[model samples]
Target: MRSSLMRSLHAAGLIDYYALLIHPLTLGSGARLFEGPAPLAEFELTGSVTTSKGVIIAYYARH
Candidate 1:
């Protein structure tokens, strides 16, 4: 459901930018940000930052 809505919004050019914060730790398994069986979307890297504790913050914009 969420993936379908995201795909629709991106397809209609409604999404201009998005950001993701990646942590150093990891779980054995978990849900991903993007889901569903659709082809992967394209995005441009705008900026990024690495915290003192090693967390990574990434910014992205529509291509």
Candidate 2:
């Protein structure tokens, strides 16, 4: 599963940069990213952008 893989990557300290895109619509319910029991990882905002349609693209790097 993707969640498991992400968790493993987090545990191994292999993630340097993580980016996520947020749309204007909400799903109400669906798979959530970054869901796990591990401690919260600190990330610094590297960059971000918004499209004409209102979609936000965010970029983050581990701190």
lDDT of 1: 0.78
**lDDT, candidate 2, 1-63, per-residue tens:** 387897789878888888888888977987767675676788899999999999999999999
Candidate 1 Cα misplacement greater than 4 A, ranges: 1-8
Clashing pairs in 1: none
- Give me the runs in candidate 2 sitting further than 4 Å from their true place: none
Per the 3 Å backbone cut-off, how many clashing residue pairs does candidate 2 have?
A: 0
Q: What tens-digit string does per-residue lDDT give for candidate 1 at 1-63?
A: 376687788667688888777888878987766565545567899999999999999999978
Local lDDT at 25 for model 2 = 91
Which residue pairs in candidate 2 have backbone atoms (N, alpha carbon, C) closer than 3 angstroms, thus clashing? none
Lowest summed-lDDT stretch of 10 residues in model 2? 30-39
